[model samples]
Target: MYYINKITFSMFITITLLWSITLTRIYAESRECDHTKCVKTLADTTIDMLIATRSVVAKNQDLINVDPVSGNYYFKGFVPAMVGSEVANDFSLMTGHKLKQTSLKLRNPNNAPDEWEEKVLRSFEASGYPKGAGFGEALVTGDNKIYRYMKPIYVEKACLECHSTKKNLRPEIRKFLEERYPYDHAFGYKEGDVRGGISITLPFGN
Candidate 1:
């Protein structure tokens, strides 16, 4: 009877242990999905705000003077590409998340993609989703922290002045681009083309 009681007690303890582990794993997975959803929402909001701001700026272009050299409207000194970089930097400082507008044909070298980013970019191209319909994936960084979110950026009519081909560019605009980015491949894009993307890396703790 004593041996039987001991075996029963051992079995009960083992069952409890198994139950605890299962519950912990379920909780962990739920938490991971929650974090990813939150990050995706934040990333989408950021991109929307950016697009609205750019649209406003683009609409106001007619009010500004043309660049004496470029012979095109100066956009009140707001270049969308330059503005995006600065905004991304400022937004990162405010949110503690890494944000960037990256591309294959990069105007700013800083926008070059890492391994995971390259894969996501290719996936976006292949997915056939409209530019506004962004997609995201959850990934574990080297430190085992969860990172998420990516949004595609489309070229607009306003974007063509700087991003279109040399044949389409004003003499001053081409010269300015040459001086700023000699290897600039970001040009030749048309309105409605998927120019690049915005990626947001959420904080590690979240």
Candidate 2:
């Protein structure tokens, strides 16, 4: 009778510990998913708007015009790169997570790729821009505390204003880009070429 009671007590303790551990993990995952869902929504919406703007501009060149003298122009109060940089900065400021566009051939020095970003871009290229594959995800810092999302950006005719080769670029546009981004490597891309991507980082559980 004494031996049976001792065995029963041991089994009860073991089950309690297991249940506690499982609950902890479940809570952690729930927190992480909440963070990921928020970031994913923002990132996806921003990319969709950016792509839609590109399409609109491609269909109508006069939608946006360059102002070499003032070095600023607006179409509905948002320029392409301006919109990207603004959204990234604002989101990072508000949420404490980072979001921005990055590429192997980066035009803006600020948009330079991080380690994981470079790897993802290489994967896309090596895969020959496989159909229906436009995003990548991974954990950062060897921990599940943070997650990354990347969405591809493709070149459209509107992009050629600043992204075309020397011959294709307008003189004024080329001059503006050269003065602004002297180290720009984000040119020479044709329609349908994968230009780069919008990357978003989110912090999971505290």
What overall lDDT goes with each candidate model? 0.64, 0.61
45-162 per-residue lDDT for model 2 (tens digits):
5455545544453544443343434535422222366545765575466556676778899888988898888888777667566742546454657655666767777787777766
lDDT of 1 by residue, 1-206 (tens): 01223333453355345434533443344335456566566557656666655555455444433554555554233456665576667666654567787887888787898877777777777756665777776766676565666777778888787788888876757777788787778988988887877787764344
**Cα lDDT, model 2, residue 58:** 53
Which candidate's lDDT is highest?
1
Candidate 2, superposed: residue stretches over 4 Å from native: 1-46, 53-61, 66-79, 138-144
Clash pairs detected, candidate 1 = 164-188
Best by the TM-score measure: 1
**Candidate 2 local lDDT, residue 140:** 54
TM-score, cand. 1: 0.71
- Which residue pairs show backbone clashes in model 2? none
Every model's TM-score: 0.71, 0.67
Single out the weakest 10-residue window by summed lDDT for candidate 1: 1-10
What's the CA RMSD for each of the models? 21.1, 20.2
